[model samples]
Target chain A: MNPILHELKAKQWIWNASNSQGKGHSKRLTTGYEALDSVLSGGFPSAGMIHINSYLGCGELRLILSILRQMPQHEVAQANNKLRVFIAPPFQLNAEFLLDEKIALEHLLVIKPATQEEALWSAEQCAKSGVCEAVFLWQNQLKHTQIRKLELAALHGQCHCFWFDNNRQCMSNLPLTLSLLLSRENEQMQIKVNKQKVGWAKPAINIKLPFKSRTQLRFKEARKAVNNIVQLRATP
Target chain B: MQFDTCSLWIYLHFTQLHLNVIENTQVHDERELAQPRAIYNMQSNQLVQLNESALQKGIKHGMGLASASLLYPQLNVHEYNEEIEKHALEHMANALYLLSSDIVLMPPNGLVLRAQNMLKLYGGLGPYWQNISRCLSQLGYRYQSAAGFSIQACKVMAKCKQGIISQERDVIEQQLFKCSLAHCDIDLKDFEKLKRIGISTVDELSRVPLSQLANRISRYSVGIIAELRGQAPSKVTFFAPSISYEDYIELLYDISLVDKLVPVLKHALKKLETFLYVRNTQCLHIDVSFYQREHEPLQIGFDSAMAIYRHQDWLEIASLKLEQVRFASPVYALKLVCEKYEVAHASVDDFFTHKSTHIETMSLTSRLASKLGQQKITRLNFIDDFRPEKSTLALADIKSKSLNHAQSVFADRPGFLLETPTLLQQKIQLIKGPERMICGWWDDGVVTRDYYIGQSQQGQQMWVFKTPEKDWYLHGYFI
Candidate 1:
């Protein structure tokens, strides 16, 4: 059996503390972008939390979405019946945009926790249940102990936990397997690895965001209207 | 030749004879400590039945209270309430009815059942017997059980404490032969004459000729012997069980603490499981009411989206609901009511097998709802309205609806929609054309706006809208 598949079935981390020494030997999740994958020496770490610190409105969620798009939907569906959970997102989750990005809407769960405590709890529960492939938690000012608790839950469930914390101070002293500092420089989203448990790192990978044209936007609207009209007419 | 009555019968002799009615409702720890306690019948002015301690102290049943009090100066005397005792027996019967429908209420303190059907129904005699015993034990009853080919044989063997009787007739006969004349429930005058004639065991009595035995003993003795040997059918009125599941416990002492109520509720839940099992149904809802003195009854309820029959699952959810309940007054009585039942569906494993996420999410939702109240947890669903606020509905409202994929028609919308539009602060680059949404005049909330996809200076994509005059509002963010 494939090692990753076997580990997932057993609900244990594929790379434990003892065997996570060799950076080259560690199993990685491909970012789907060849350039970023080559720079990170394969891809992001498959298990444990990956902390991303970025300025507000700096395409932080977009960067993560790019990596998620790389993984096949069937693999995730088969791994465990876990959905993609986004907890206490900064903005209201627009279902339409996610569909445009090719994300399965049924497999995406959004939870809006009213308090920071609840957000941490929701994240931990989602991670510990092993019913979610990825838990994108947007919580600000989590203590060291809270982050450690989340790390342990992620390790035990063998689920990928990503923390999008805006508070830079609280992000430090965390057990994040991979920590990246995201910034916008020269019209490109730059991702610099500040911490790597795998013992090796590369220079910042400047990812260029795709720009949409005016005609393409109008074409999308006209096409949607046509489809809706056709559906409306098709129904009795 | 022996009578070939090929049916298994069970006799349940509730051993703690005196306290049946009172103990079922209220736990009497003090009485338990005062072991040599005698229940005095007020009308008779006599000790009806004394516990083993009182018996050891030379107190006897039907003896005058004065004599019993003289024997043990500290003897605890309690007024015997026949109604309470009868009610308790009925409750026990109802709980046991789940095991077998053909139950006969042996008045005062016993129950008889046709166990042959239950044996096959439960797959075999062993599981069937264990199921009844476990349920009885869980219901907080003290009883001795014996089974045999005939109900008479089971009753006699059980009264003699002959232990569990196998379904085989020979084993029952062997057990009956072991019991002396003194243990058999027969008239005292007839028993003495039979004892004098060397008829000690039931086997000896069975060998005596009917005419000869009738001449020495009463016809009742002969009838008893005939029934034990399965020669005559005992005229028994099998108890019909109540349709609904309900059980009550009266606290010996009024309890102010909520935790103290858990054990009683747990016992009631165990009975509910039996109630469901016998009916071949599952409970979807249960209501618990606490009877307090001089106060309105405090009621709590547990409801499952899916039908559940397991005792532990009910207890688990009840405990969660109980944690949220604050007792205003000391609870005196507790009752568990489950009037309605749904047909039991397939096993739980099938419902959760491939839908682990759905199961976990459900559990999460239940936990959050329990802790944060039911109104707190919600989800989003889209409507046909163009207005952003009116376009979504709370998921909890339409619980039965399945989550569907977002239609491609709404493809040009942003990832997040603000509840209300806020004034745009930063200059943004226009990446796409203004998609004009100009409907909604029919409704009270009318809107006409030009919406565009814009990228902020920090590379964040946003959905912005401009109205008739020239005011720009940030509708939502892409992420």
Candidate 2:
């Protein structure tokens, strides 16, 4: 092979087209949901910034909670007793739910900055501080440079950052390891992969939730009663 | 007198302490020390201390102010302040406390240090005196020092300008014998009586018997002679350094902007660093008070996540805190006070862990707290309570012990709770049945509610509650 072609291959400018598992796909964490994990190649990337855009409470935190529960179980994370920082959550975090899920309360930190700039800054600092295992940031809006800086910070600290945007605005073109948009469809939660580093963008996938809509349950109960009446009339 | 033969005492007599302290406390200028300056005693109406230039201009001590002014027309006179001079001596003693532990303050400008123990630590008298001299030079004071077997003997030699710095008994006694009676700490009438009796030097005074001296001169003079000869023990009180740190720096010119205070604050923090570093202790909080021209002093307090003693760390936090302060008036002085301290312990890191980073968790939290308010960063701890609002507690300090046994009655709860319940505006499909709760009946108010997990039209999961009156309100979010 020519030296120029070899250099291109070394720099990863050219690679095999059929290679399904790339560099980023090798190091991923399972999302605890089998269907969602399959759609996310293996799971979410082990490190770097992840952007999740959704409505205020469309199972976004639940998706992150699954990964957060497994973080401390990792060998490296367990050794350091790293912290999980939450910067500017929408409301007061329920301690009962987190404790029930077996999250270590001692390793949890919540920083409610007064301004948006302070929130972004606190998020970046927590991500860049290597003492943290993960940093979850909830903000209304973020600029392109801020996202890039946050990505670099997460990469440097080797900590995973999950940024939740609930403004219902169109997603801006920003560098990220993975970008997800979440919604609810009846009894299932829909997750669409908008951007992924190593794989092609996937279509929307629905995962069944443990919660059932009361209206749907009521409709089914009414239909069963009517069927019982019809069955009785036919028997007569 | 029963003198400890194994112990040695060193006395430092600050000759021009009043003038030196005035020069040192004022802002330094190139021409300030070059000009003729003298400290004039208002009560005596005479010159008490003269700087080098004033002495060179023939301005002698005890000369009347009119004659001193006639001798040097350009003489800059500062009124003698006994209180400031005493304070200056104490300040010097505090600075030298690190070198020597036992210090006795001889007020209005003198210090007596027990040097026998320190000599052994420093290995020799030469090195010990060198260290003391270096410290005095940094303090920028003119002083004469001497060593002797007794405190009074060293005081007499140092006051007479003998400048003898030795640990050996023979050398100190020889120097003490040569001290002139006129320059000693004796009354004018006693000096005259001693001079009339042909006792101009300490050597001649020691030759007279104590019984004869007691009958001839006053008892004070006889006692002075006995103490100088190591025949009588001198009453001495040792000075103890203050444990708390408080340093005040008055600016020569008022600074209107807070940024200009950095250099002054840095100097004060350097002093605090030495204070803490020597004791191997660290402080958690420091209060900085700025004295303005016309307003009440503004005091800002800040703290670290962990106890820290480094000057750079405090400087960084102070600068961040200063950024938030809006100066109401021009500040003329600044005071840094730290009353609490803890023993410093070396933090051991995991050797097997591979991640190496410059920032630590405590420092990061401190930096954020200094810039943002301290209340912004907190830890969530569960508290055993029936009400959702009282179920969790936010703690300011992460290291504080939290209630670990707090268990909520409700098995299923939302991840986020609204501060207060709001009227449910949108139509919702309830998924779970009402989990009824009757709480706070014995307290401020009664609360009877039925909670249900609901999904809104926009697909947002909400925790809603219904009152007995059939009114529904959104209470929390499942996210």
Candidate 3:
């Protein structure tokens, strides 16, 4: 076996997060496609992290749209969903697909910025809105600096960041907590976690489709045990 | 209405007048007549032929260069000299539109008018040949207008001007017996055959009776028979404008404390937004300039509203803009103005028709503002304009915060906030280091944020939305 493949196998065991303890956090946002979710720890979205890579053929977008398309809704008087999404200037959508999703068309909105400076400003503002759970940039391009600021915003607002692929140039050693590269195999999405903070990287994990909203997973990095159980056996 | 170039001062001086209109006048413009290419060689004088091949290839005289090439092969088209066509079509249409309100300008060299009404206006249009001659004199073009109640007669009147110039259909009735074959957009071939046999002209064609022609050449021939008799056709329908908007404001303010008067201003905004929603429109240029105030009153461009509407998704956007208020010392009066309006289909039954939860919420804000100071009111509007500070806004009198109740916490509301961290009261071990944040470059405030979902020694949970550009402010709490 190749040494790197063996190392990755060993890394996968440890990175497969087993513990679910702490406050509100999800393991990964199901990319809808089954093959893609396997690479993520579980079906959860991390608030402070960035999904930096994207794929072509609209397969990646189709995955997200399919999952979001199934999100439950009612009249405003009944209740509100805990999440919302924001896209920046010149960002466009297929009106036909959206209509097909049974996604409430009124919930969808567009923002046209007069300039790029305005686009960034709008992105940061949306992330802070509190109501919007995630902020996505249909970046014709992206810079490391922009990613870093967005990372901080995701942390500040406890918001998630999904970087859909564009004309973005690839780079290395980003400050992002988790960076995954999404590629296509047989028109199915594949997620490869290049980095992680809590555990080791795993084999490419494929998540399930029409991804149901599951935020029940949150795990803190392993901490030193506070209570040491002193084993005292009764002297018999 | 009467217009005359009859006054001396109104007569544009020769120096200031357009010289090209007078210069382009040719004594006998050959282009006006239908002549074959060989006719130029038979001319008594040497003639400069313009676009002889283009004409033969089917490029009409008045067609534009961009499209002329599509009709004619081997056509060398030139860019339009606006100065030339300006004299032709517009001068022609203006002369025609003066005849009636329902004039339609046909391409190149034709003018159509709904002259039925004009006959009465000009005392039966019989003596109007003088007016036609006078209008042509004012315009440099030498033109001939054929008047008739129907299109067939008008076309026949125009064609018969050269060899025989007689208005009487009875005299034309005699001459029609001598003419040869004819052709037009209509295949008047059968009618030409009938006319060549014994039915000499249109009068002779009409003499055949409607039912006989209907059977002879289809119902269209019957239509031409009616048209030849100078009868008016049925009116064509026109469409109504696709957009509709109506707005008005009522002011009942008697005293000033301009800041205190935010309600009246906000009501106008609510009314404006509702009106736009009904019409399905968006606003870019919005303004409300104060007409009267205490200490030299002020004006505000509706940019504040536009900013709020732009970033309506976020709640703080309009709030920040409204914070720029400079209330008058004795602020005595207020006015609300909607400067820009557009048509957008706002699903009205949801927000506008009656009070839905949104309206109930907006109304609640209005009530709250009425009870509380207007400055304290704001509305949580959802907008996709990416800027956070620009998303949510305080409608001067509109209330703030969503109408939604706080989520119960026996179980965690998956994404609700935890308590925000304040400055350290005591040292604590690190569960996580600060996650830094820096945003906002376009609007000038570069935020560098550091966030933590840290637990204190007591295990109380907190959610914080903070800015490194400013001190951390506690935003949410967990049960």
DockQ of each: 0.27, 0.34, 0.01
Instruction: Give model 1's docking category.
Output: acceptable
lDDT of 2 at B217: 76
For candidate 1, give the lDDT: 0.72
On TM-score, the leading prediction is 2
TM-score leaderboard ranking: 2, 1, 3
Candidate order by lDDT, decreasing, is: 2, 1, 3
* Candidate 2 lDDT, A1-236, residue by residue in tens: 99999997675444454674655435877777888788888887878999998988777777677665654335466456677889999889988877765567887889998899889888888888887888999886888778879988998888888999876665545678788889986678888898776766799998875542444555677788876654335555
Q: Cα RMSD (Å) between model 2 and the true structure?
A: 8.6
lDDT of 1 by residue, A186-222 (tens): 4577878776665555678887755334346667777
Write the residue-wise lDDT of candidate 3 on A90-188 in tens digits. 222333233333333333333434455555555655555433445555565566677667766766666656665544355545556566665543323
Tell me how far the alpha carbon of residue B434 in candidate 3 is from the true structure, in angstroms, after superposition.
Answer: 55
Q: What TM value does the first chain of each candidate achieve?
A: 0.75, 0.75, 0.60
Q: Give a tens-digit lDDT track for model 1, residues B1-479.
A: 23346677888887665565455544537756556767889998888766667889999988987787788898877777665556677877777776777888887777887887777689988888888888778767667788877777788778889857476666777877887767666789988887888888877877877767767777787787667777777777778767777777666668777788887778778778877876789876899899987689988878764567778877877787787688778998888888898887554665546655665655655555554455544555555566766765546531345765545435556667787899999999887768888888997888889998788776667789999978999998765
Could you give the candidate ranking by DockQ, starting with the highest? 2, 1, 3
TM-score of each: 0.71, 0.78, 0.30
B61-159: candidate 3 lDDT, tens digit per residue: 444444454664444322223333333454444444454455544433444445444446676545444564565566554344454434444545544
TM of chain B vs. native, candidate 2: 0.79
Best by lDDT: 2
